[model samples]
Target: MSVDLETVRRVAHLARIKVGDDEAVRLQDELNAILGFVEQLNEVDVDGVAPMTAAVDASLRRRVDEVTDGGNPERVLANAPAADDGFFVVPKVVE
Candidate 1:
């Protein structure tokens, strides 16, 4: 559960980050400290604690799911350089 210098180097390479020997050593110490703290947190008892997404309770407002156009096709295609059959027409790319 502890991070070593080689592990730090591997992680840096995987993350595409360039780290020198000194920086690698420093990151190694920091990662080890973080893992140590997480290990300490695992020692706590949470037998009856409920999982929550946030501290406050709230619900999202929703609208009916229905499909309808903007009620005007000519207006929608008014600014298009080329439109046909109530749709924007683009240059064909393939034969």
Candidate 2:
């Protein structure tokens, strides 16, 4: 598909972008060139090629899942503006 000046104007309006006549014409040419490149890409054959996220093989390191109370509450609350009973205190917002 190709883009015309009118199509460029409509796209700009849809995207809430303000494009004057000169800018619209430039955008039209650019969009047409991009679509032409996509058309060329469609001619390539990739019947057996596998989709990949990256060019290199990669894997994530795994860790065992464990749960326990945070060992140090006093250290965690050290920077609180107001703390009580090992918890950060905040002004109540609801009655």
Candidate 3:
């Protein structure tokens, strides 16, 4: 649960980030603070509470699903650099 400088360095390497020695030390401090906050959160009681998506209660609005031809293939393909037989043309890489 505790983050050290070596762990922070490993995290930076995994994320493809370039962290200097000073930045790594700063990140180690920040990670320790975040872990401390999480530890504080673990002490709270929430036995009977239901999980909620939002504070207010309201049903999410939805639209009916229907299928139709988007109706303009020629218009859609008009800007293509290279198109053939109603499809975008790309160079074949595989034999």
Candidate 4:
């Protein structure tokens, strides 16, 4: 795909970017180079490669799921700006 000055101008207009004719020519060259690099990257062979989130081999640490009250309600609500009846109070929104 060839990126021309007209395409650059149209892209700039769609993106709401302010670019003069000289800037558009420069942007055209840059966009063309980027597309060429992407074309080269698309030619790589990865038939059996597995998708990975990170380059390092690390596993996420997980614990067994258990359901219980956090055991310290007063400590958790200590920093609340407004608390009432063991609950954080908020302004009533409905009439």
RMSD of each: 9.8, 10.1, 6.7, 10.0
Error of 3 at 23 (Å): 1.1
TM-score leader: 3
Model 3, span 1-95: residue lDDT tens? 88989999999999999999999999999999989878987777989988888888888888778865587889889999999889988999789
Give residue 3's error in model 3 in angstroms: 1.2
lDDT of 1 by residue, 62-83 (tens): 8788866688999999999999
For candidate 4, report its TM-score.
Answer: 0.45
Instruction: For residues 1-95, write the lDDT of model 4, one tens digit per residue.
Output: 87878889899999999999788988999999889878886678978988788888888888779865687889989999999879999999889
Residue 41 of model 4 has an lDDT of 62
For each candidate in turn, the TM-score is 0.47, 0.45, 0.49, 0.45
Model 3 CA deviation exceeding 4 Å by range? 10-17, 66-95
Model 1 spans with C-alpha error above 4 angstroms: 13-16, 63-95
What is candidate 2's TM-score against the reference? 0.45
Worst 10-residue lDDT window, candidate 1: 60-69
| Cα error of candidate 2 at position 2, Å | 0.6
Write down the lDDT of every candidate, Cα atoms only: 0.90, 0.88, 0.90, 0.88
